[model samples]
Target: MTKPDPIPARLAALKTTPTPELKKQWRELFETEPPSFNRRYLESRLAYRIQELAYGGLKPETVKRLEALGEQLDGGNITLRRIRADRDRPIVGTRLIREWQGVQHVVTVTAGGFEWQGRPYQSLSAVARQITGTRWNGWTFFGLKNHRRSA
Candidate 1:
């Protein structure tokens, strides 16, 4: 029986035969860059296999890993910096304004045409200026509170 062709030879032969010239070119491009080469090829191959298992639509564990990968690629952590920058920008006539009538004398100040929590605001700067009586941190002030529901 013949032995199976090795992966590198198979990959390198994709464009043409596995001749010395092709092998040399493939080695030059990929041998010294094993991480990049393996990541480019192996990640997709494995991710696709995982996706196929997930396509069964019932494997919760597999689905979770795929979702995690999606988050990493989307740079969810880095996006936080972008969100802070966005919240600091001034809004121009885009958000709805509401005045609070309680004893606190604070304005509810909805819709500053920006989003601090998941919900959109009228304007982050305007909301900050109006709520705290001083230009305060909009992201901190407007963060959503997850209150536990009473049983």
Candidate 2:
């Protein structure tokens, strides 16, 4: 019998595939085509080609879907609290004192003005709003600087 044309040569190329994933791909695609003498090998070759084609030409939609799916599979949410600090003594007026972490600074509040570590500020409320926003906890009036005691 006459030997068939050299399709087997094409199929033989699948043997050089370096990975198991490529081997599996060959198995799946080879199953679809008609049986040549080297059908098993050709299947692998076809699978490799398919894999190479797929890897080389990924669509944006596929990339986005994969990213979304990955996020869905392994994802979580987080809540963040604004960093704050306490003062050894309160400044005058409706001042809100706070300290930012990772910095050597103290903020003080007063009715007429605010101070950050003694730097004068326009208004205590403005300073408070800057450090802690509109609503922050833990501030109250206790006593004025005892001027009479100095006398």
Candidate 3:
């Protein structure tokens, strides 16, 4: 007889498990009280913990590389890290196309900033201003903001 894998079943049960049960599992796995986050967060963290324990975690080299990358991103400043993390900048080489006044406008995300009509712009809001001659929220103008209602 061969041993069956229990990870898949455990992960599947997370969706149907009650919040209290999920918290209990979190406490047992993490050996600490879970943060006061939502049920989805609890389930997701618990799932990751279960799988990490069953298999393994990232190698030391991978952890070091990720830390180096983070330092490069924010120079180890916690506030800058949070701000950069929250900003959903589009990937480089992406083309953002919008139509205004019956004319099509295209902006290309570059490594340094954005390029529109063969001109470089430091920020999307600046690009928006050039496009519309008025102040506008770039994310909203580009339709990237998540339209979710907060309770």
Best by lDDT: 3
Clashing pairs in 2: 26-44, 30-43, 95-109, 114-121
User: Which scores greater on lDDT, model 1 or model 2?
Assistant: 2
- Pairs of colliding residues, candidate 3: none
In order, candidate lDDTs are 0.46, 0.47, 0.82
The TM-score values for the models, in the order shown, are: 0.20, 0.20, 0.52
Order of candidate numbers by lDDT, starting with the best: 3, 2, 1
Q: Model 3: residues >4 Å from true position, as ranges?
A: 77-151
- After superposition, which runs of candidate 2 have C-alpha atoms over 4 Å from their true positions? 1-12, 16-55, 76-151
lDDT of 2 by residue, 6-32 (tens): 545644655675455454555565555
Which is better, 1 or 3, measured by TM-score? 3
| Candidate 3 structure, TM-score to reference | 0.52
Q: Write the per-residue lDDT of candidate 1 for residues 1-151, one digit (tens) a residue.
A: 9977455454443444333444344455445432323233443443343444434444799888988986765557767655654564434433333333442322333333554334454545556555555554454444422321211
lDDT, candidate 2, at 150: 22
- State the displacement of the C-alpha of residue 76, model 2, in Å, after optimal TM-score superposition: 6.8
Candidate 3's residue-wise lDDT over 48-84, tens digit each? 8999999998889999999998788778898885456
Model 3: number of backbone collisions: 0
- Cα RMSD of all models vs. native, in order, equals 18.0, 24.9, 12.7
